[model samples]
Target chain A: MRSWKNHVRGELQQRDQTEKLPFIGVFTSLSQMEERFEFRKTCLDDVQSKSLDRGGREVGKDTRLLQLQLRESEHLAEKLSQTVSDLTTVLYLKEAELQYWQSRVSHFRQEALSLAKGSNAMKATLSEFEYTVECQSKELAALRTEQKGINQALEQACREKEELLQRWMEEKREEADRLNKYNAAQERWQRFAKQLKKHLHNARTKEFVPIVTSSWCGEAEMSTSVIQRINNTYRDTTMSKL
Target chain B: MADDKDVLRDVWFGRIPTCFLLNQDEVTEREAEPYYLLLPRVSYLTLVTDKVKKHFHKVIRTDDAEEMWFEYEGTPLKWHYPIGVLFDLHASNTVLPWSITVHFKNFPERDLLHCPSHSVIEAHFMSSIKEADALKHKSQVVNDMQKKDHKQLWMGLQNDKFDQFWAMNRKLMEYPTEDGGFRFIPFRIYQTLSDRPFIQKQFRPVSPEGHVHTLGDLLKEVYPVALPTEGGPKRFQVVIHGIEPLLETPLQWLSEHLSHPDSFLHICVIPVPSD
Candidate 1:
């Protein structure tokens, strides 16, 4: 009995030392210790009862029952130890699955941060493209309006050129007509003067008469004076006509 | 006076033989033959040159042809002038069948007005009539005429319908009996010796002293140089419709009988032929 008590006290000491495990491990170990304590209490009761009976046949039957109880307790202890090992394996697997999931979550977080930075850069580029497009469109519109204005001015200039050409042609025609008339008159006057000069030369040559100074000088002199008067009258008439 | 009505018929029916030959520089599809026509003396050149234009267009290429203009002796013929005036001014001394060059290019833009269509001729004719009426009756006679009446006058000239034109023209010639004649005789004196285009002035058919004005008196007042001095040789021949009327003809009589379709007495003073 003293040896059995010593064994139970050693088991209690081992259970108390094992209480320093993790929270869930400590709880499972404490439950297993309580079951062992109950089993030990039942075994102590059976031993006491057998001591009290003391009859030879009764003691033999009690010894057989105690042996069967001891076999049952050993089987139960083996099954509990297997259950504890299986629970420990499940905890280890669960911890490994948690570690894998935590690593995946961290990887996803890093990817999300990189995606956010890329999106910000894309947004800036998009806004710059939009701003540049707006400026280019504004410049195109201004150029289009300026082109229209230049076209209108070109058309106006063309119209003015046509009008100026018309006016210039009119003035040129008038000047040409005046010049033609002046030339025609000049030609006619030139021809007329040429004819008049020929007429005067012919008249002077025909009036030329040689005077002979022989006897009867007074008669010849009077005849020459009469011829001179006739020639003078002819020259005066020609001059008046001119 | 009854014989004077025949003068109008004679003037209207008067024609001049013209031969149109294409210019040497013009491009032609084939050899262009000369076209001949008897142009009316009273009508405009552009008005009566349709046949001439068609005849020339037959030989000219479509792309090479341009506005048709007439040239005579290197002088661009003014289409706006009456055919007789142009003939007497530039071609009276030439032989029969006055030779005119047909030009399909190089239009004399500086010398001649463009006659793109008959409308241009119509407008010019109507304006000339209006100007004459203004001088004769101060525009009262023309203003009283209906639009159709004016159109009839133009149509008559265009179609060579003398009766149609005379029907509307007699009304314009009318004047008050007490006035003895129109308010003023519209006359244009064209001299070959002067730089002026023509001499136009407001002169009454009768003088204020009640004496009938004469053609000689009009010339003396407007262009003294056109007349000959006393006992001086004749230097200028005052011609009207290819003939010289006696200077003693009354101004009103000339305006009524010798005036052109536009109702203007066109007197061309040319130098006397030396021959």
Candidate 2:
């Protein structure tokens, strides 16, 4: 039983150094300490009783074995007391760490709750913004349509102005041509009037006259005027067709 | 839209093509009053009056087979509304005392007038106090007072005529939002269906909410005369008014002739209208 107790103590104490759960290991070691103390007291009582009794050789040998067991148990009891004291400190440290973890969890939970509220508000704001954007897009489309119509009107006005300018140039060219023709006709008429006056003056003052101011002369003059009128009519008809 | 819905009730009054179930045995054997066998069945009503008092009587169904009687106390008159039966096998046949009987035949492919689209719809104008703005309610009076009598009469016909047709028609009143759901409205007739002058149309939208009165329910309330003369097929004139042009032929022909649109006309195809 003493050997088994020693093996259990060794295994339990070894676990304390290898694992982070020192508080649980220390509690198991403390339970073992109480058991070791009980074992030592029983061994010491057996040795003291054997020393007082007068038995056979067997009893004398039992007395020696009990003494040795008593010595080993006493050392084990001391080791167990130290382990129990160490267990008390470990348990205190574990309580402190647990308290720290609980407070940390609470702080993170509150932060998460506030963040969730903020995100929800952001979502609502985003939705309203999206709605506004949609309305703006529709209004922009309408404005663009109106602008397109105005641009088209402006382009049409420009085209009309260009056409009007071209027509004005055409009319000016035709007017200039008519003015030139009228001026030429006026000059010819003025020359004819001068010649007629000069001939009449000659008839009154000069002593001699050309062969005859006769019926043949008058007929020839009328025939030549008719031929000029026919030539002018042919030329005007040809000009109009061209 | 609600105003338009109320008009749907009136739309079926004269609109549905009514069929005649004449006692062929009487109309043919005896000289009768414009009675032709409706081949199908009908639900009708009657209002009685005298020098001193006014009585109202309504017969929901008519039977030719057995004797049946009903008495409503203190009221001088009786009113019956025939709850329409949709299929014949589903129908229960019964005879009102001194009245006629209706047999919704399971397989009457031969005897049936088979009014295809033509239908005569009876108005079930029952009134109530709920919604005062509503002068009349187009509903069945299956309330507590009417429940016992209704059960008694309906059960009396359960032997041969189980109202299998009526039961089937009742099952059809689901999904009211659907287009043709109202077409199966129990007691009302087809809109624009006519037979009198034969004013007709090739197409009409059937309003589903038209009320219906079954022939079985109508005969259950007919007042028996003291003379108790053997009644043949009681020729009842169900006068109706609102109608459409295209559905007149089928409606009129079915009531007067027991003919459906497809059965009577060679070209019986009606184009369904959309809203």
Candidate 3:
């Protein structure tokens, strides 16, 4: 009986070790435990029948003890199966949680990759914008300098125009003065010409009346040269008086 | 005046039998059949040639096609002009069933305005009406009309509904009885001899002395050469709506009866057909 108890203990220890091996090993060991319990039950039945036949009180007590030990081992196996079921449930839950975390990790990795690509594109765009700004600023500076040059040219042209205008006005003023002087001289010359015309008409009438009166007195033969000399002397006297 | 109302109906219902033939140079998958249509004289060519386009489209490759244009003999037809004006100006003396060559390439940009779509036609038509109103009523009548009324006029012409068009157009033709006629007659005279497109001038329907102006008077004032010299050969024929109306016909009556839907008297002065 002691040896049987020791063997039962050793079987329980082997089951425990098999349970620690793997899930399949635990199932195999469970089947082995069932087989051993059946065998031990058969052996107990045989021992009980024999003890009954012999009508021995101590043998029946031993058989009852063996039955008690077998019952205890069955109780231990039931408890161990409950623990295995609980451990399987915990393992399934842990596997699900690990899968969920792995998927989350992959999603974060994708997000990080996309963010890196976006940043690279943004950097390129920013550099392009900066280059355009630099080119635009340079063009603006060149335009400003060109505008300044044009302004100076325009100012110089304006100054030259003003100078030319002043010179033209002075020349016009001088010409106007000369015209005024010439007009005055022309007026004086006209007056002198009018007086000379009147004097010539008067002298011609006076000389012609005397020549007509002398010709009427039959002085036709009186030398024509002498009349011409008289007329010349009278015109010279009229000019000197003017 | 009662007899004159028939003339307006006759003018409105006038149609010309036209034959549309594809040009020889166009790329076609098969021999294109000629399309025959009774084109409305008062409408535009581009507005009435949808069937012609479809018939030709069946035989022509889509990849080689461009904006469709038309030609007769050799001259590219200007689609902006009324079909009747185009006929009277170019094909007045031609044989029946006016043959026009359809082209899908080589658009004559210098000779014709691009149609693009039906909206362009609408815009052109509306602008013409407004211009005529400006001449007739100082633009008072057209401006006073509602948007739907204007749409009615366009829709009536587009759908070939004479009553619908006339319902809105009658208002544009009204004038004070005491004034005897419109403020000015909107008229354009086209001649084939000159490089000028047309002659447009401000002309009154009545003389200052209250004498009613006649078609002859309008022609004499604007183009004296269009009239036959006394006891001389007729050098030109003054055509309106494919007929030579008597010179003594009152200009006001002609304006009321003979003017196109655009409200303008388009006169074509073509050389006398020698044959």
Each prediction's RMSD over C-alphas, in Å, is 62.8, 38.6, 42.6
Q: Write the per-residue lDDT of candidate 1 for residues B102-171, one digit (tens) a residue.
A: 9989998988999999999999999999999998889998999999989989988987877667767877
Please give the TM-score that candidate 2 achieves against the real structure: 0.26
Docking class of 2: incorrect
Which pairs of residues collide in model 1? none
- Model 2 residue B6 CA deviation (Å) reads 78
- In candidate 1, stretches whose alpha carbon ends up further than 4 angstroms from where it belongs are A1-242, B1-3
Q: How well is candidate 2 docked (DockQ)?
A: 0.00
lDDT of 2: 0.34
Candidate 3 wrong stretches, greater than 4 Å:
A1-242, B1-3
Scoring model 1 with DockQ, what do you get?
0.00
Q: Give a tens-digit lDDT track for model 2, residues B104-214.
A: 223244322232211121112122111110211122223322434433333322211222212221221122333422222122322112332222222212423542322
Residue-level lDDT for A71 in candidate 2: 78
- Encode model 3's per-residue lDDT on A122-173: one tens digit a residue: 9999999999999999999999999999999999999999999999999999
